[model samples]
Target: MSFPKYPEYKDSGVEWLGEVPAHWGVKQLKYLVTCLDGQRIPLNGVERYSKQGSVPYWGANKIMDYVDEAIFDEELVLLGEDGAPFFDVGKPVAFHSSGPVWPNNHIHVLRPGDSAWVKSIVYGLNATNYIDFVEGSTRDKLTQSRMMSIPLAWPPHDERNHIDSFLDHETARIDALVEEQQRLIELLKEKRQAVISHAVTKGLDPDVPMKDSGVEWLGEVPAHWNVVKFKYLIAEFEQGWSPQCDGDQAETLDEWGVLKVGCVNYGVFDPTENKRLPDNLEPRPELSIRKDDLLISRANTRDLVGSAAHVPMDYPKLMASDKIFVVRLHQRICRSRYAVVYLFGKGVRHQIELQATGASSSMLNIGQGAIRELWIPLPPDSEQDRIVHELEKREADFAALEQETVRHMRILNERRSALISAAVTGKIDVRGWQADQQSRQSEILMAAETRATYG
Candidate 1:
């Protein structure tokens, strides 16, 4: 529903703050709050954090590693200093903190002179388009100097509380609806994985006799299937080449693009995950990608290492990077689909998780020898083709459903941002806006649900 506007309005001197309630005054942050930028103690020196430690600690936009003791025991607003899309309304710039808390240097900590000002200022800062205050080209950085200069429309104390209380209840309702959509997206993904895992290990014929495939992960498969080492099924398995190229200058040009390891990270082939080669660079012929070639990541984070994707079509100039392996199954192995599904299947993914090695916790690697040695259930040529055909049909169906859910979530986020901006910016007065939690919750979800159903 469209919210009511103030009965009287007057122009505010600031450009972004056009008009506000007649009595409302425009005030700079410097007058209303004390900017404390020196209280920060870096998280690197401490083992415990504010969230996990004796007190609460805040970073740029989240509760990161906490610190030992609570430095500030008052109400404050946190404006992110870096590492966020400040211009994007979907990612909020301002957040509230109360009680004993320690904020890192990555945020501008503000203790408003009046405690009652806390929520109104936070809502105002969140509603503000940070494109006007934020700096830096590669990453956004909001400094204390710029933050103090920004102005917010200040209403009366009673009106401030009303606005604050109104938003607290309303935003929570919006947040709950968004949370439900997020949970559904995750459930859909899990179901997709389960469907493929079941189809590959157990043939479509559920009544068919089952036998232990001998592998620990693959408990039982059709009696006729053979368990074999990964090496025997492939004609060639080679790691991709690493060519010297400037990351800053690299583009996705047609003539000289090299596949980055990201090509396999998405669970499907993404050719856009390639970098343009240097002018002088010439890649070897074997490094070029063909339609049936299967790309597998050899080095990445714990979860993505050994991620595999079969090339759906030929990409002539694209060469796999050193972080991935290019595999060509033997001609006798029809339609590399069976092997592709088996490698990405839940059972084999678990194996990859266990086998991936790394010098550090963050980075992981899988050796070619380890990949070749891994065991897999090998179905006959004809059976492999049949399984591939069935999986392709199921894959298309699930992909459409997933895309719709993703689109719905995007729409909900945009709506949430617009609603907050309108309430705080005097574009709409929500002082009298109220709804039972159930109806508001359903309203938010239904808007997105209807879109999903229609689209």
Candidate 2:
């Protein structure tokens, strides 16, 4: 759907606002809204924890927590002062909040003269390019004075209301579609995990005879399979060295680098998740990663503490960190891919989480002894190869569907941003627009019919 352009247009002096509707006026943001930055109060994590309650505590980009006290009770708009996604055009840096709320010092609060203008101002600010106003060497900072001088297209009251209403209805429709796609992606992930868990724990043959595995979590397994301890399958295991390194990744494969715990995060080796080794430090040639090396994280968050990945190829320039454990399986009995799939199953993951230990909730560590004692249900060598091949085929199919859904979401987001920018900048006239009530009612009826039929 396309919107009609204004009948007449005039050039605006501002470079970003090249032209506007003849009747529309252009003005700086400070003239239309009151700055409430002085009223904001900062809160540390400990302080916020102590005051946790119903009121939302806002930071530069989102709600950080809920606090007991309210700093402002009236409706207002908040813009990021720093640490926001300023460069991402599809994402918003300005948001509105109503009722009781506490905003931190990292956001600049704005009180528009008319409550009706709040949504319009937010839409305009999000559409505007902030490159000319934002400053800072490391982080983008929109200072109070710079934000005040930013330009906006000011339309008559009635026209502004029309744009806001149209945007509210249209964006809601797009958001719903985006939400559906997001939910589909999450469902696909859950299904993928389920398939892996079932394939690894219980063999692919559904009718195979089963027996109790004795362990409660590993309820039952194929009668032919054996439940063995992990230690029996390992040919070799060793922890890696950690050396102070540069923050950036190595530019070339020839440059020395040390792997971070995140290298095995997704159950696949990521060579790029490594820091460049300093030139002055001596390299550990013995610890260099090799092809078929199975790596696991010894220290990470609880969910990822025992994450393991099978190295598909060699990364000779990279050495593992102390937080990672390198292992080699007894190839005669177990394949690296088979071991990785088994470790990633829900049953094994439960054991890893239970054994992980740490003083802080954010980080946990698992010892080598704890890992070796974990139980594994083993099938014959030929069965392991067949399971791995079948899993790879299924994974590829799921990945293609996920990629298509993600592509659709990207297109929808681009359309949303373009519509908002065009309407707020007066590139499109919305005064004559009205909501299609009959069409919305038809959609509602169709949705109901779908549920009835599907259910």
Using TM-score as the measure, which candidate wins? 2
lDDT: worst 10-residue window of model 1? 446-455
Q: What's every prediction's RMSD, in angstroms?
A: 4.9, 6.1
Q: Please, what are the lDDT tens digits per residue for candidate 1 over residues 1-455? A: 43556888898887776777788888888988898878876564324411255576777888764545787888998888888557764667788888888887888889889888988888888777667888987678888888898889887787778778777776777788778878988887788778888978897888989899888878998998787888887788888888886464235445667788887874688887777777787767678889888788999877788888889888777888899998888847545667777776777888888888765434678888867887877677888888888988988998898888877777777666666666666666767665553454556444323211221
lDDT of 2 at 110: 96
For residues 118-183, write the lDDT of model 2, one tens digit per residue. 998999998888989999987899999999999999899888888999888877887898899999
Pairs that collide in candidate 2 are none
Q: What is the lDDT of residue 419 in candidate 1?
A: 65
- Candidate 2 segments exceeding 4 Å error: 33-60, 63-73, 100-107, 136-139, 231-244, 285-287, 298-305, 350-373, 436-455
> Candidates' TM-scores?
0.82, 0.84
